[model samples]
Target: MAGTSEMIDLKSTPHSLVENFNLMKGLLATYGPDELQVLREKAFRNFTEFGIPTTKDEEFKYLSLRALEDGRFAPAYGATIDRFELEQSVLGPIDAINVVFINGEYAPELSSAHALPKGVFIGSLKDGFTVYEEVILEHLGKIANLTGKLGSTNDERFVYLNTAYLTDGAFVYLPKGVSLEQPIHLIYLSKADHGPLVSYPRTLIVLGENSDAKLLESYLGMDGVYFTNAVTEVVMGESAILEHTKFQQEKLESVHIAATSIHQSEDSIYTNNNINFGGHIARNDVNVWLDGEHTETWLNGASVGLGHQAIDNHTRIDHAKPNCNSFEVYKAILGDHALGVFNGKIFVYEDAQKTDAKQTNKAILLSPTATINTKPQLEIFADDVKCTHGATIGQLREDSMFYLQSRGIPKDEARGLLVYAFAAEVLEKVTIASAREVLENALFAKLKESQDMPEKGGE
Candidate 1:
């Protein structure tokens, strides 16, 4: 454990950040060999140079990190929680294999990975390095390299932080021509009773050529004011098909920042469903690189914020090769004084002829104080590419409420029904039936809570 020095000025440099850096250096011996040590040093330097992003940064212009910085959270290295307590906080059902992590450390007893397929490997990153050393070394930091041009200054800093503090997370590898019958569920739980803490969880998924698999990553906080900085890197081999889903439901007082990067090969299919329901301040970045021809990608996301919560969703899809296709839809529902932000970008390189990309972001404000900022952008250098992006921000339609009310539905029920319908458009796109059911029920409950409050502009 690391302690912050009170004599240090917090204004010039965040004391907590500095303390965590020192803690990481001290724990470097536990990470791995000299090779990983060098990589860690490089990542630390990147974090120091980029620093924390401020309001002036273009990518984070709509959101601020002051709340997180002021918290001065140190890294949670030796934190521990009971297995029963951790199991109770899991998001999905207990049927799937659950790779559980508590306070950034892998808990094998809480995890169930004994029955995986013959060739499929699902385990912790720290263990993966020892068992699949060659593979892990080859692809561990490759995505970070590819993301050099994808993130803002703040994003880069977080990426570096994640790399420097990278300890334990889920790692899955599917061999060529194999299909996983059951989805691999990765569950991350944060429990920080001692003090304000932070945890960095990393995940790596690789699908071999012609392989098929599904993955679910869920983040939950049992209690306390903490921060969870997580990063997931996925590589899809030629003709690989993968369905990925993420659900984030941290404690309301916690700050959650996550980044997911995907690299698609030729003829590969990648689908992602990201759902955020908790956290005082939550930000998610999803980036996909279509590095091969004939790649197909689908992205669907939904965020629900209440009280003083702030949720931001950012996504980017790069059609680097020709004949690639992508579709994205993100929706947000905010109530009380909550704020929501959505930014989606599509980039089609000059060589990506016949590329087709489409993005849509819709936001609903349930209260007068609730705010939303959405930006959808498309940059296409290829003349033959079909790229389109659009954003919509509005309140629940009174007409729709009236129409539903005319059907004998109560006013509150009508509003809840309409809100649920709006959010279901993206939730229904989630292919995992179990995960979708949980999310649908959660959204309905959130909508009902929002409906209990008086209309923002009405009596």
Candidate 2:
């Protein structure tokens, strides 16, 4: 690391990621400046300066990175995967134009982008560097840089890592006044049939003025003890409307870390729904910056943690201009010894006089051993702004459970029903019918499994 005085030795560090820096640099050498080589160099330098984050870091204070720090995972390069198996993991109906990536590399044979509307570009980031260099160069890594926005922090290091290893993910570009009738699906699956592996999936979306679109970014795994470090950046032009949904369902043995940054222009609207049901250790960072007046932003998230799983959701919504409106609601259901963490911050700058922002986080603990930590904060510098934030952590209400049980429902069934109702609030916010249906089914299935476990005193 450059900022730190001590040099981290790749040979001594457990599961050391620095060992692959040479390989990554070699890969970058193959591309010219037009292909993002310069940006990659800058990001790699930042990663080296910051180094890997530890539990001691405030941003990662609750979650431990030991699994990622100690486990040796080879970079997934040219890993083979079955298309049929990939198809089986689609979240919704298989009719939409889907862009599939296996092991962090774009697989055109498994993707369906042929039916996209005119003036809408959907393809791989690797190709976007060459085909859409101007757009990629303008937006890529601009948000990942943390110097001016959030300041120096360990959480930003992951973005630097993704920028350095940026290979192939999804790229969507909508020109002015274009509207897509069907949603675009970007599917990323990590299948480590070869061995323990690591992959970086990067996505960039640009929507021009008055453009409208819906996009789904899904991360899935097919039986692997691997690591997924993914980053997505979205830029919305004036009067643009984008409904974005992110679903993470990696295997229980894998580790997943993701960062999504969205920038909105004047009078634009951005709605996001994030759902997590898998991954042994998962952390999600979502940030939205409202830079223009009259912009609207909505964020809703739901996570289910069972067994010893650990899931964390961190979000920030910045109201930089006047008359901007933002709302956020995040819910979680934890069972067994699982742990869930939620930290949401809403910021209203001095010039954002008419900003209206609200944030709420709620969690339900199903077992006595299950745990949840939630913090909702609002920083308002604008005098006329309306901002409120709150969080609640508790188990299901005994009276509600008793009422359901008195209505002839079994104890397990009553518990399951309560859990479903609590989680469904966020799932219902998903505007995509197909995606909502899939999430509803997955939520219940998880609740049912939790209900089967032995009773705990928390109930």
Candidate 3:
């Protein structure tokens, strides 16, 4: 393996370099013959052609994939963990059916399966892929095509790396007319006794026609600093409704990159909520495609960064058909030299008439050294469409702060109240009241860090 300086050759694409290509090949060599053949024949071509993306690429400009070039991480160890111990360590207080991954290995003992109603299938994709390989082949790798779109770096390499060493992740299937009463929880945890640990977790959720469900995916880490690269693909059938939330709560020393893609059919409703709170460097790519008419989609996110942490979110919502609707709102709170990046793109096709799309991104920098870069883009080809996008970057409203202070509330309390109100827009959308309260309390705990400052010379 080559070091960071020699991994990505500036003059040439990553895959063209002998070391990068060989490393890619060596990574595949560990997998089964069938898996190796599948990746090499199906996805490896994309990596070979484009190499990895650099800062010159507009979409990946903010995210530094260079970390992967460092060759400092190794695949996580597969260890046997007690079911009760794993559950206690990871799930915390979330209320849902649990699917746990320990050290990148699936722990069946820690998972619970309530008899899913008719038209619902929830389990490991690897199991389904092994037992129902034909079904898996139909939808896998359908969204992120191999063709070099954003300067030749598709997620295929990382995804292929995942496939090469994947132990297991959840696979959810909702049949036509089915409704899941309880949310499905998928948790990924890494215990980093071995240095240079890397874990790739993948999930695929398929919702049939007229189906409704909610999914919560969470990530947590142990003492050792590790790397987690995850991918989730969602396919929503006609008139299907899906409320999906992905929460990242790794340790401060961790590095994580995740990609979430949703494909919607006609009249389908898909809502995606992403929350990020930890990681040394974190990046998320969220993409939703409206393939059929009358589709409705919502993209909402909240992220808080402290210390030297960095969070980057790149999202794309494509209006491919007619009469589709989409709304997006993203909020970020940065402090103590943390960095936040928000890049969102909305594309309306030529035939996407009567499309209604709106997007807004707001950021609050609690520290002067904190930074945020926000960009929202719209490409519309239809004339009969309602599209709007706007972004704002600043600190909390001082006037609101002053108003609260004047009402006899202390300045710290006033700031927390105003900041909580600003974030309430997204928090209110939490479907489960219990889940909402948990997240709300977590936000408060984080905000308290800003409030609990020492008085200057006893005030």
Residue 85 of model 3 has an lDDT of 59
- The global Cα lDDT (0 to 1) of model 2 is 0.81
User: TM-score of each candidate?
Assistant: 0.92, 0.92, 0.87
Q: What's the lDDT for all of these models?
A: 0.80, 0.81, 0.73
Worst lDDT run of 10 residues, candidate 2, spans 1-10
* Index of the highest-lDDT prediction: 2
Model 3, 1-459: lDDT tens digits are 112232245336322222433445655464433553565444444344444455555556666666566656655667555665553653456778778787666777777868878646677765666555655567766654434222222344455544444445678887789998998888887778667677778787888899998888888776587888787888899999998888787888888878888889999999988888878888888988888998999999999888888899988888889989999999998888888999888878788899999999999888888889998878777899999999999867778878877878888667667676666678777796666766676666666555332221211
Worst 10 residues of 1 by lDDT: 1-10
Stretches of candidate 2 exceeding 4 Å from the true structure: 1-15, 32-35, 90-92, 150-154, 451-459
Off by over 4 Å in 1: 1-14, 90-92, 146-155, 397-399, 449-459
| Candidate numbers sorted by TM-score from highest down | 2, 1, 3
At residue 153, give the lDDT of candidate 2: 39
Clashes of each: 0, 2, 0
Whole-model alpha-carbon lDDT for candidate 3: 0.73
By summed lDDT, the worst window of 10 consecutive residues in model 3 runs over 450-459
Question: Per-residue CA lDDT of candidate 1, range 55-82, in tens?
Answer: 5666677778887667578778566767
* Segments in model 3 whose C-alpha atoms lie over 4 Å from true places: 1-7, 10-36, 80-91, 146-167, 449-459
TM-score of 2: 0.92
